[model samples]
Target: MIKVGVVGGTGYTGVELLRLLALHPGVQLEAVTSRGEAGTPVADLFPNLRGHVDLDFSEPDPERLAACELVFFATPNGIAMKMTESLLNAGVKVIDLAADFRLKDPALWEAWYGMPHACPGLLEEAVYGLPEVNRKSIADARLVANPGCYPTAVQLGFMPLLEYEGIDLSCLIADCKSGVSGAGRKAAVGTLLAETSESFKAYGVPGHRHLPEIRQGLETVSGQQVGLTFVPHLTPMIRGIHATLYLQLDDPDLDLQSLFEARYRDEPFVDVLPAGSHPETRSVKGANHCRLAVHRAPASNVVVVLSVIDNLVKGAAGQALQNMNIMFGLDEAAGLRGIALLP
Candidate 1:
């Protein structure tokens, strides 16, 4: 069994990771860390995992974490970089669910995250953990940088268009909305039920942090810099991300539906819905799936693609487990087979 340790097991992403890992047939839960909640039973904090996970929240200890074969950092951005080097040196494969190791350039990372990268030397070696794009690399990587929630949905939505030359890369737009959980399991005035409920508004119009990461992933696929206008909004829900992507197509006669379907044909997690279908965020809630649909008007050069995913699942923890499966040569769907939760 793959011994696993999770750091910062108190947040939404952390708890999600614990929930999924507990059901994984190939995994053995080793340690779960939370500095503030150390000594608290994991189930006491999250009643959902009461019967499955019997471990208590422990202090973030490098030596203890090093003993595990793989360690997942579900903590804030800066925390992972501080402890990753020690874990890596101990032969522990590390997967960071934060932005710490996602960006290759240290300066760009520091610019957005507002802190110096603790281990910039490892930047080039850290593989971006989007299984659809970097599956092979993730399998061989000692360190994997999991993509952010917004980037995951947006990139998967725009990928099929960006790969084909008929689509204009210079003018791409991602109008995305996510549930309050994307803000993380925290106490914030903006995410309060009273504030977010019965309201719909956009934020981060100037430049969200996920912008660079999304651009970087798209640019890599298209082999050129892309002009992208990414705007994120907060919805009155608890989970899921819905990204409506707009792209200018040079060829009006191109079969976009076939293109998207063929592009994701082999990807188990990306679902391309039937033509004319609009995917809902709830359809992918609690599941590791990105459902997409492609549409266009007659004689129109514009294409609209709708993408939906559970922000905490395909966006964060579930994807982390997918990477773990790849890293260990286990079935990619081993622990991620849970269906989306419905009303």
Candidate 2:
């Protein structure tokens, strides 16, 4: 069995990993760390995991974590890099749900995260854990940097279009909406019920930290530098993301629907809806699926694609577990075959 350790077990993604990993037949959840909640029964703090996980939250001791077969760092951005080398040296695999090892350039990471990467050397070794694009890398990786929520949605939404050498890379626009949990578990006044409830507005306009990450993923697939206009909105709800991407195709004859269908035919979680279909975020709520639909303008060169996913699942923790399963040579969908929660 794969013995797993989770750092920062009280956060959204950490609990999410706990939720999914607890049900995994091939996994044995070993250690869960949270300094504030140390010595408390994890299920008592969560209540939701009552009988499923009886583990206790403990202090984040790197030495204890290094003994596990695999460790998941669901802590904030800077936490993973500091401890990654120790875990890797002990032959322990890692899947980081933070932004620490995602970007290739340490300077750019410092610019957005406001901290210098503690282990810049490992940046080359940390694989970008998008199952669709980097499956092979993830399978052989010792460290996997799970993509951000917005980047995951935006990249999945635009990947097919970007890959077509016939498509124009100059006019890519992404208008994505995400739930408040994407902000993290911190008690921010803006994410409070009084402020977010019944209020719908876009926060990051001209630039967002996720823009560079999305661009990096597109460049990986397209094999060219891409200039994109990415705008992210905060939804009043708490669990999903919907991204509407608008692109202009250089080849008007390229069939958008066929392109998506063929590209994602073998991918398990990505569903390509038929023309004129609008996939709702609620349909994919609580699941790791990315429901997508593609449409093209009959009169213009613009193509619109709608993509939806549960931010906490496909966007964060669930995806992290999926990467873990792949890294261990287990079935890619193991412990992640949950159906979407529909109302």
- RMSD per prediction, one decimal? 0.7, 0.9
For candidate 2, what is the TM-score? Answer: 0.98
lDDT of 1 by residue, 1-343 (tens): 9999999999999999999999999999999999899999999999999899999999988888889999999998899999899899999999999999999999999999899999999999999999999999999999999999999999999998888888778899999999999999889999999999999989999989999999999998889999999999999999989999998898877888899999999999999999999999989989999999999955688899999999999999999999999999999999899988887
Clashes of 2: 0
Candidate lDDT scores, in order, read: 0.94, 0.91
Candidate 2 lDDT over 1-343, as tens digits, reads 9999999999888888899999998999889999999999999989889999998999988788987999999998899899989899999999999889989999999998898889999999999999999999899999999999999998999998877888778878999899999888998899999999999999888678888889999998999988799988998999899999998887878878999999999999999999889999999888989999999877998888999999999999889989998999999999999998868
In angstroms, give how far residue 55 of model 2 lies from its true place. 0.9
What are the runs in model 2 whose C-alpha is more than 4 Å off?
Answer: none
- Residue 289 error for model 2, in Å? 0.5
